[model samples]
Target chain A: MKSPLSLEPLFHVGPAGITEPVVVSWAVIALLGLGSTLATRRLSVIPSKGQTLLELVVSTVDSQIRETMQADPAPFRALIGSIFLFTLVSNWSSLIPGIEPATAHIETDAAMALIVFVATIAWGVRTRGLRGYLATYAEPTWVMIPLNIVEQFTRTFSLIVRLFGNVMSGVFIIGIILTLAGLLVPIPLMALDLLTGAVQAYIFAVLATVFIGAAVGERHKPVAPSEKEP
Target chain B: MRIDWWTLGLQTINVLILVAILARFLFRPVIAIMDERRAAAAKMLGDAEAERAKAIAAREAAEAESGKIAASRDAVLREAAEAASAEREAALATAREEADQVRASAETEMRWARAAEESAASDRSARLAIDVARKLVARLPDSARVDGFIDGLARALASLPEASRDGFGAGERARLIAPRPLTAAELQAAHDAFARALGRPVDFAVVVEPAVIAGLEIETPHAVVRNSFRQDLKRIVEELTRHDGVHR
Candidate 1:
């Protein structure tokens, strides 16, 4: 017997044929690119309408970096600001008709996590030199080196799983709700989808900022009283 | 659930292409614009601080200038007061000097007026004495013999009196004929002048009085005569006039 929540497609294409999800992902990317380009082109002293909207988004991301990094935003500005906007748009793409959230798939989520993980490692090594960055794992002594290395792999795995699980859960719930009640019943769940989209985007951006901050050590250190002392 | 490897492969390729294009074109340019905006905010904050400092400096300079102007004004006022006081003192000194000169000239004029009045009084006394003498002689006789005898009598009346007389009797008459209250030097000079005429030692006392004003008198145990009556009357009248002038 077929489960009520089964999502198996009704039709099939020939070998190397495209699916609806792939086609929708491609269209979402194109839309995001067009919107971003129109918003960015022909910059002004006092921004044009589209430019103003883009500046608002970029400035919001920049402020978050300044708050988290708390140091010169020069180094982490490019990576963190890009990740924030990209994740936000990608997560929101599922709201359009005939499209699915690509982040709900493990492969897509892993790709994004890998970008952050590689950047984190690169920045850590660059800031403290390779020897120093690797030595951070040793922590107390040489005896803990193996455990520290295992911890690094676990951390990377968790990053990929966390985003994947959350987004997949939202899709699964929406599908289950739609199948049970048919059309209008999915409206409340759709509202929840919008919230979930924005929350996921925020979590991904903040986590990236925190990871970069950790790489630079005292860069994102708490705004302690001693900071204002000197 | 079952795995679908082929579907996953195609989806992976599609996702990769989408991410790559979006990252390159969309996110990259947005971040660039953000950086430009951040730099502009920092510059504006710095400019505001600089303007605040400049405004404070300008205010301080204005205060200093006003303070200097006030000090100069005070100094000018002080100098003006001092100049005014000096001018007042000079004027006062000139006024005092002129007043002193006027007072001195008034004192000199009063002295001259007093001397002229004294001379006029003395001339009147002399003229009255001469007139009285002429009247006395005319009552006696106008003949040459009688005129010559009266002239001789008048001469005899001017002679010195005896020294033993006292009071208004014989002694008073003698005092009226002789000088009283005389110093030893004046007595010595008088004796030296009259000793040759009398051919004897002479001693007398002289006193200043209005009783015998301008003429001499003689009195002795043997004889007595007076020629000082009219001169004494004239002196009395003049003194009475001076007293009346003071009262008036």
Candidate 2:
């Protein structure tokens, strides 16, 4: 008979049974906050090189807001930009020797996806006033309300699965390649891990913007011709 | 591997609390600072734009002031020129009036002096003539001949240029004849002037200036008439003297 692989406790938990991924996720968040704070310490009207890079990231998030929301985007500026930065760093955690990527686990991905889903619902209700937001589902036919309700749940599911699958796949592939090669031959696969980490972060942010945009439903059309007609 | 629901549920709750606390404490303050910075930048830009507008307005005002000063300067120059011309005209008028007064006084003095000298010379000549005449009357054959010669000499002295013509008998007279028609206005003015002088209108033929100059003479018929080039020349010369001071 073959022996099963013995799984030992990776690390100690606190009184509340906090696991490795939770601590690593917090660490990743702290690192991202520290990096962003240091980059923008001396905020200049004319940006220095480092601040320019930070500004480029912020403006990219702002542009995504402007495109997907089709409005001034003042509201989503901090929310989406912080999410992108945090996710990007956390997805890169496994590259370090002692730290595993929190996003590789379904629980971490679910927390991130839930943040996006709740934010999307809150913005939709805030912009469209609850009754109008619910009426969006009755479009094309009043009978399709149940299907529309399922769609909202499916969107949250898809967000969680997509992030979890991509991060988990990259980690598993790199682990398998290392086990087989056992040496420097696994370098290319680790390189791919870095690439996948960045790509996954971008995909999560983009999909979040799209889903939020769909829930918000066109945001009253910035400049409506009908309002000007009278 | 068996699923551990207790571990998963506890981890999810822990993560939610941590995220909420982090977002509230760290991210919120940082975002607020960023928004404040953005507002300050926009305010600075607005202030710069306002200052630029004020500067442009000031420049335009300066240019307008310059234009007004230039226009005022031109107006002052024009007024000065008008004042100068008025002064020159006034000076010329005063000079002309002074000259006319000097000429009138000079003429009056010469006339008085000439009258006194002529009276003295005439008295001496009359005395001499009287003595000579008395002697000649004594030597002559009849007193009537001496008296008649004295009368003839007196008439000659009175009409030195045309004494014989003046002595013509009442039966003899000169008349005028012309060859062309005259304008109605000229005829009417002449007739009106004559009627005013005579207290009654008279009929007369009107003639053109060319016909009178070419065909008429001074002694033509019942009255000695002067309607020819000689008369026209005299009238033109008299008019030129009045207008141009040639004879004055």
Candidate 3:
């Protein structure tokens, strides 16, 4: 079996090498772009069946974002919606023969986690201002500042490891089983892998939502009956 | 697992591109459409509410106008009834007045007709009485009539005042009238009778007249004596005519 870690370069664009995962991601992007354009080409007050479906998806994402962040979904709709759709599409890409899901790679997962990390900071700064956002690390006590600062990078690292580990393990197990037992014997494992891929994508999205919520949410405070306004 | 910097950069770029595409083509347009539909629905609801209010107001106005019309109609009907009643009463009063006038005129006409009838009857009676008396006296003997009238004339002359008797004696002439021509004997007898009643001599000329109605009439310068059926009949007719006028 080939090493799951090593990417086979399909082409070169100057010093940069275009790999299999990169090619597959471009295909996913193209499919998503084309679908979006087609679905939204003619919008109406009275929705078509296709438009109903597209709206349902968008609204579901919007609701999920609102629920998780406990804030308005307007500013974060595109970012969160894009993340969920990309992750879901990448995880499900294994259904296509000869296509390796981009989420199964360490590089792709790292990039996604890095995006979440940066987006959280940006949103936090926008909501609380740079000084207030920085001040959040010193919450509860000034002594917890160092630990709170470490927690940001650690959580981002955990997101990458979690998505990459789950997708890569599913791919590896399916491959090993298919090699040992015939292709038909590995069908159940492949189905299980599909489930695992879906779960991993969902977990990644949920965690990203949590991180972004923490960044943009109102500063945590203890509830006291005496402190409540009339 | 191996990390590839190029793959990482490529994936990041793809995700950004996807987000941009989805935001532009999908999220923005879909959200805009939803907002527009919501706004349209609200506008339609507001317009429906306004129309309902206008309809209610119009219905109320129509009802008010109908009420006013009904009231006016009733008032007009009342006035018409009053006018009709007044006109009926006036018509009845006029009819009664006309009936009374007709009754009064009929009574007056009856009274006038009765008076005229009575006057005619009285005139006829008077004429018949005079004619009957004239016919009776015409059947008398001339001598007997002359003698009877001479006797009445002598009595009337005796009743005269002494001065009037003296004046008769002094008169130039005296007239004597009878309803028929008098005989020579009747003339002489009349002169003697007058002279004896007067107790002096009286110049006498006898005049014969049929209009005396078989009676005698003597005239002197100061007095006259009438004892004629003609005179009696004239007085009786005048009295009857006067009595009829007074009764009427």
Best by TM-score: 3
Model 3: how far residue B145 lies from native, Å = 16
Write one digit per residue (lDDT tens) for candidate 2, span A1-230. 43111112355555444566667766866676566556556766656777667666666777777777776665665566656666677778777875667777776667767777788888888879899788878976999999988988898888878887888777777777777877777678778878888888888878887777877777634664576857
By summed lDDT, which 10 consecutive residues of candidate 2 chain B come out lowest? Answer: B145-154
State residue B210's C-alpha deviation in candidate 3, in Å: 18
DockQ of each candidate, alpha-carbon based: 0.17, 0.07, 0.58
Per-residue lDDT of B1-248 in model 1, one digit per residue for the tens? 43344445655555455556655665567666656766887788889888888988989999998899899999999999899889888888888888878877776677657755765665566566656754553454323212222233334432434442222132332332421244455445444543443444334334344344333444444544444443445555666556545533
Model 1 DockQ, alpha carbons vs. true complex: 0.17
lDDT of 3: 0.84
Show the colliding residue pairs in model 2.
Answer: B174-B221, B174-B222, B174-B223, B175-B220, B175-B221
**Residue A89 lDDT (model 2):** 78
lDDT (CA) per prediction? 0.61, 0.61, 0.84
* Chain A vs native chain A, TM-score per candidate: 0.80, 0.87, 0.90
TM-score of 2: 0.60
Residue A174, model 2: Cα distance from true site in angstroms: 2.3
Give the Cα-based TM-score of candidate 1 against the true structure: 0.64
The per-prediction tally of clashing pairs is 9, 5, 1
For each candidate, what is chain B's TM-score? 0.44, 0.36, 0.57
Query: For residue A197, what is the lDDT in candidate 2?
Result: 81
